[model samples]
Target: MQSKTSSYLANLLQFCIDNKIHKARKILHAYLLRTNQFSNTFLVNRLIELYSKCGHPTSAHLLFDQLSARNIYTYHAVLDAYCKSNDIDNAYEVFAQMPERNSVTWNLIITALSHNGFEKKALENFYLMMMGGFVPTRFTLASVLSACGGVSDVGCGKECHGVAIKLGLEGNFFVGNALLGMYAKCGFVWEAIEIFKGLPEHNEVTFTAMMKGLMETDRIHEAFDMFKLMHRVGISIDSVSLSSVLGVCAKSSFEDFVVVNDNDRNWYNVHGKQIHGLVIKLGFERDLQLNNSLLDMYAKHGDMECAEMLFDNMSEVSVVSWNVMIGGFGQKYSKERALEYMEKMKNHGFEPNEVTYVNLLAACVKSEDVETGRQMFDDMSCPSLSSWNALLSGYSQNEHHKEAVMLFREMQFRNVQPDRTTFAIVLSSCAQMGLLDGGKQVHAALLKDVAYTDLYVASGLIGLYSKCSKIEMAKHVFDELPQYDVACWNSMIAGLSLNSLEAEAFIYFKQMLGKGMLPTEFSFATNAGTTNVSLGCQDQHCEYVKILFYNRYLAK
Candidate 1:
């Protein structure tokens, strides 16, 4: 009779766990106490698990504390309760007090730590687990790999990958996906691709990771292709994957590729609309985030009509929806429209956030409305780095160079750290005003932050040095760049030409061409324009530059 009763109670507890019936679970706990069955270790563990699963962390912990006949499973149940509630500190306490721990115990704490942003500590625990002579399970390796990716510790990730291979668990489904994600997050897209291809089966998650990896690395076309392949392969494309594809489309619209037919229509825009159509067909139109992505993609492409139409059709609009509209109009330099939308957003009960303010400031920049921009910026309670950059950029763009330098000093006085954008904008202002000393100070700060190699910041330094007639300093900045983009090369060419080094400018241009870097019209114009100023001299180098410019333009 007792055996049958215990079996029935076990079934009832499982049902409570599965359906998360907290109230009913409480009644069962009371009945167990009334019937003197509360002392049963297995039943108590199940009760603890039920409370944890129901998100009653305090109740779970209280019951765990009262249980004197605790086993490993009991400890595991309570630890999971804390982990699920994001009470990692308490979870660690329980882990430390455990008399014995198995592979599952180690995995629980490691996963808890990793998910709660204690990634480095999680890796340390993994090593400790190894030193304790416990062979890691697939789940253990997956958690450690996730931590590696979190911290961008690719060296440790590689070591974990080797362990996976040694344990012959690399082919396990969970481990394989984790490996792919780690490689992708670490910016090794090719390595991710190799792992992706080797996987025996593809799922939505696997494909999504690969697409995001491609997107992050600026491989927009390839990311979109992966989305298409996911659809073609008959994998169920979730809202996340669809949203990611829309982001790729938004970025691709800005690429220099001529997405056109004979009529010169943008195929990228057409592709974005097609994705929207697919979202509707798949019955995912009600997914709020996916719709937001659709709206954002349309906005980024400057199709305000489509964006507004989609916005009106969205049944459940979020703050992101309004932010996208404001930013969209801002991009088109429609300051009045952007302000009007802000009013409408307030009427609809959405308060402006940092991104909204940044977009508003950008609109103000378009009209050189620095006074109004200043008023809006002052209203922000705690401005973010982006907010600072927006107003600083506005000041620089509107030729408020002196005021811009003043703002930079004020920002420093407040101990507000400047990022690459802030440094670049301030440097541009210093260059325009010929404040070589101020530029050098900004350069010193940039070096302290180890951001001297950034392409945008480096270009600003080059411009400042060149404008100050420090051609050698400009050349040194260019040489220090880890890799040269076309913009950097153009900056170098223009700096040389500005200093009347026409011969050297021509040589760099030739080298640019040799490296297969296509020169834009600005590149040709800068070199030709600077050289043309000396055209009256009739020097051989002047003749060579003129001939070179005409030949290049004519060749195109």
Candidate 2:
């Protein structure tokens, strides 16, 4: 009778596992517990697996704790539960307590760490696993490779690639794809292409990874070619790849498309529309992500008509879809239309998230509606740093320099840390208002943060000191920069010209050319304006300066 009953319950548990009948599994769990069969290790492991697979991590964990005679299978099941549920801290805790681990054990924890953004920790554990004399499986190498890519540690990733080759698993489809991804993410597009060529079979994932890598390296022409190749070679086109390709199209300017088609400024619209037509032809029109991409592409290209039409047709719209519409209209300076859409979004039961408010704030910036922007910002449950930066930037851009400085002080009083954008914007405001003391305080705060190395912030400081007749302070900041981009060089030159030191400004401009830094229109304009400052000198010397300026900058 006991044997028959055991067979019946085992079959029932298998049914629950196969069908994912959570309630039935729970009933079976109770029965096992009541009849003392819960002590049976095999039956308990299966129950734990069923619970884990069904997304009931708490129950699975409870069963794991209740088990008196746990084995490797028991630990694996519970570890999987935590990993799948993204409970990384608990997952690592379980791993730490495991009596003995196999390759599978290390793979689970490593993959979880990689997926959860602990890339460094994942790589650290991979070496520890190697030192433990546990050989990495194909899955283990793939996970470790992903961690390597996340951290952009191409050196370690190449070593892992060598390990894969030594194990004769380099050509294995899963490991090969991982290698492609790692190389591509590390900015080694050529290396990724070599792996892609060597792979015996190419799937949608493999093609998408290659396309994204190519795009990352600004090889958009090659990426689009890959997209065309995917369709020609009969590789299945998925939403992710299509969305990525559409994003590239949306962001591309006429200059970007000029190489593909000469002098065609409308190529962005044409390419976006072609992709939209392809999406419809391929029956992906109903795909929410693809539809959102279509909307974004149209919106970015300033085709609000098509964007709205596609947005209306989306059967299932996510918050991202709503945000895209708002951002699209906001950027086009259609403030009223953006606000209408925000109202409509709320009516559709979507609460305005941080991104939603950020878009609205941007719209306010474009329309110069500072009051409305402030109201919208205050409405946020907890305004993010980005929200603060948006309003602060709006103030600075609109010439409300005093208001910007005041808002920045409020940001500091609230204990909200400012990022690079915050420092740059506030410093600009101080420079504009000639508030040297306030700029110094902001600069002091910036020095305590990593944003001191930022070129824009450095330039803003240069402008602040130069405007206050403190050219020495401005030059000190310029000299202290580890490297000088064109902006910093221009700032230094402008500071000398602003302080009536035209000869020094000329020397700095020549040095800028010597350093191979390209002079922009702003650099030319700054130097040209200095010609006026030298008018009181000797006529010959003034003519010499004018002739030099006209020849060097105005002629161009």
Candidate 3:
């Protein structure tokens, strides 16, 4: 026969199910004091599960400790409670002591490991589960696949995919979606696309995965097309999907590709304006990210007016929005407007980040406003290397080579370690001034600091040596570079030509072309004229020189 304590406990369990958790807990506490027979294993586990489900793991743990006898269910309930509470360490400790473990127990531990950034450990446990002769379920496979995706481990992802196929879980929607996401994020774009196409019924998640994969691979046209396909098929695009496609549009709308001829220099305004219209029509203009993207699109396209309009109209501006506007005008050579906006940004209560300072310094450099640049530099609470590089490059471009070199020395005195850009600007200035001693000091500092091995720094060193009329030193630096990019090769070739090593420049140019690296217009013009003059054809050389000079004039 049921006692009063049993009836009261049953009522408390019913109260918990009916969402009266506080009342249920109160009644349970009253019954515990009213009767000693209520302290049973079943009653305690039920209460623990209730507390765990209600998002109170500490209460669940306290109840578990009060139990006189512990079972596998008791351990599992508390371990799951710890997992839900994001206390994986305590969960693992409990798992370590459970003498009797089941498949559910293993799954709980694996999930805890996966969610806590222990992807490799999670995969290892999944393998352990399989070797222990337990058949993997959809939940187990989904969790492991998610871990693979998080780490972008393609080989491990492929192995998991094979396991899923063998277990006949590949066709399951949740498992299939996880596989698609894993392959997409791992850069297997084609494989992800194939899987997406093979789905018998594609959901919103399926479309989003394919679109994101295409965008990541820089297939922007295909991503946009897939977005249209989603609309045509009546699949509603969520905020994530819309945001992803808009990001692609924003990127493509601002990216300026260099063309060899003046006529081929296509402006980005049309695409940028279209995207802006679409953003407005879609009512995403108020979104901070979309507004920031629109500002970037206009700034990059040299539409300062549109950028300013968008920036001013933004109801809620982020630091990024201000940075993009300042940077956009800076890129378009509107130095005054850039600086003004930066000042206004501060007035509007936006504290300038590192990016803001970098953009402002770049504008000061473009305008050759050294005094203003110096003032800004000195005013910085803590300037980064990028800010220093901008000022130095500006000084170099304005023919203030000595000042730029002096600034490098000052930076060294301040213990601000120079990065590759720092080395590039200072070396460029040293080359312009023929400061062999200063250049050598910088080289020594680079060796000591151990961050100057990048190709840009090596290229700058070569240019410095060539300008200082140390062709042998330039060649030595070029030889020591770990890898040569197009810019590096161009700098070396130009350096050789500038120092009157026309034959060597021609040879390097040929090597660069053979490696499928296209020469810039300046490189071609400079090298062709130099080679012609060196070959003793004065009139032909002069003719090519005239054409080169005229081309430069027109480019400006």
lDDT of each: 0.88, 0.88, 0.79
Query: By the TM-score metric, which is better: model 1 or model 3?
Result: 1
- lDDT of candidate 3 at residue 219, scale 0 to 100: 83
Ranking by TM-score: 1, 2, 3
- lDDT tens readout by residue for model 3, 1-556: 5576576776677568467465466566556657674457777776777777777778788877878698988898888889988898888888888888888998898888988999988988888888888877877888888888888888888988998899988888988888888888888998998878776777888888888877787887788788779979988666566666656665553343222336866554554466567677767767887677677766766668877777778899988988998888888777888888888999999998999988988877777787788898889999998888888888888999999999999998999888887888888889888899999999999888665668878888888888888889888888887777877887888888887777677678768768877667766776666667576554655565466556656567
lDDT of 1 by residue, 347-439 (tens): 999988888888898888877788889899999888888988889998998899998999999899988989988999999999999999999
Clashing pairs in 1: none
Q: Which stretches of candidate 3 lie over 4 Å from their true place?
A: 1-226, 229-235, 253-268, 276-286, 307-315, 329-356, 396-399, 402-420, 436-453, 469-484, 516-523, 534-556
lDDT (0-100) at residue 75 of candidate 1?
94
Q: Candidate 2: where is the Cα deviation over 4 Å? A: 1-35, 120-124, 127-133, 151-172, 186-201, 217-219, 257-268, 500-556
Question: What TM-score would every model get versus the actual structure?
Answer: 0.85, 0.84, 0.65
* Tens-digit lDDT string for candidate 2 (412-433): 8999999989988998889888
